[model samples]
Target: MNALPNIVDSETGQGLPRYDLRVENHGPSDLEFEIWQIPYNGTPDVKKPLRISGLRGRNLALIEHRVLRLLAKAGIHLGGLNIQDQARYALNEDQALNLGLLFRTLAPMRNRENMPMVADGIEAMGKEEAAYWLGMAMHRKYPRRVLMALRFLLIDPKARMKD
Candidate 1:
């Protein structure tokens, strides 16, 4: 396995920053994962962390939308304590740490981009439209925080059980 890259402070761009996880291939087989950088407070310096994990071979596009719905119902903020608690409850220690890192990176960028809800009335979304736009905005500004928020949101019982 290759040495994991050092987690850097997003704002100062300094080294020796502490992140939730530093992903590296543990096995000989090749693995693919996505990395998102989430910012906080609209400042490039105060980032959360990096999330690195293996995909479960599911349809991520669909999962992403479902997760958005969960977030909307939960009323959980990206970097809020509720989200952190949820991450702890839903994921294992390592997963939670990874998620925490991701949240730090993504939360700051939430809603930074403008994604119109309606465009020519062509039935723009099937589900979780608002969440999708929010995620997109998060991705543009802070990719990691958005993922962390989504991770917890998807597994949050209160968020999912709502009508």
Candidate 2:
């Protein structure tokens, strides 16, 4: 059997059994903060939905590998599904809708490499097409921060910096 990866806690460096991330308000204000755990690889049969309180009372999907990585960095572990398993079962339509709303509100930052993918999916495409591809990527990654960055790109094509 393939051994699971040992994702260390960003702050503590302790090994984690599973990984999960939660969004909370940093202070009394509405600003959102991401709390995460270490990464692990396991079966998807035990995966569960992630609840983020600061996201306007919506539960965010947590089935993407990247999302797992982000969570691991913060010290979270999914109970059942590992990174690979999450990649297999991406988000559904309703999840995508919720993610879109979160993305619009969060407007987080992302890596530069992913910008092109977002651009290719949006430029010259109709609104429906743009939404579809963006939705697909969002479902696959479930990285709310990255999705928010992509949402910004979608809203303003020319605003994104060139790769």
Candidate 3:
């Protein structure tokens, strides 16, 4: 498990749950990766949503993967991710929301490298709403970039740059 530090929500006065990046080997060549939320008491939260879009089992991996990709495409490359290794980092809600907002305005054009001429239909979206769009992008599998986006979301703004 690769853990990231917890950040407190300013309004709630409660720290958010720590998150860890985990990868499971499902087959000889198939690897599944996910971001697991670790609440206080140092235990992993195992409550998987019963249903997502009528799908029996769906996880945060899909949306998170897209988020990472969107950030990367926007020229904010949070590097040093190794699919075979596990490491810890730190990320807060504000950071996530900011990244989402960045993607919202600069979201790439449909199935092409260029961006839209005008930011149409783009509005301020909270984290949950942003997540919904991420899932929708994953579900529709459109824009081509969504599916082709990176499959990891391991980023730490505080980490020291490696030489």
lDDT of each: 0.34, 0.39, 0.37
Model 3 backbone overlap count: 1
Q: Pick by lDDT: which candidate is best?
A: 2
lDDT (Cα, tens digit) per residue for candidate 2, span 1-163: 3433454457876643343323433333222323222223332433454332123211222223333443455445554443323211223223333333334433332434443344334334554554565445545656565456555555544444552
User: Which residue runs does candidate 3 get wrong by more than 4 Å?
Assistant: 1-6, 22-33, 41-78, 81-83, 94-124, 130-163
Predicted candidate 1 versus true structure: per-residue lDDT over 110-146, tens digit per residue: 3212111111111233334433534453456765555
Residue 101 in candidate 1 has what lDDT? 31
Error of 1 at 3 (Å): 34
Q: Ten-residue segment with the worst summed lDDT in candidate 3?
A: 49-58
- Cα miss at 81, model 1 (Å)? 44
By TM-score: ranked, best first: 3, 2, 1
* Model 3 residue 154 lDDT score: 18
TM-score of each: 0.19, 0.24, 0.32
Q: Which structure among the candidates has the greatest TM-score?
A: 3
The superposed Cα distance between candidate 3 and the true structure at residue 84, in angstroms, equals 3.0
State, as a TM-score between 0 and 1, how close model 3 is to the true structure.
0.32
Candidate 1 TM-score versus the reference? 0.19
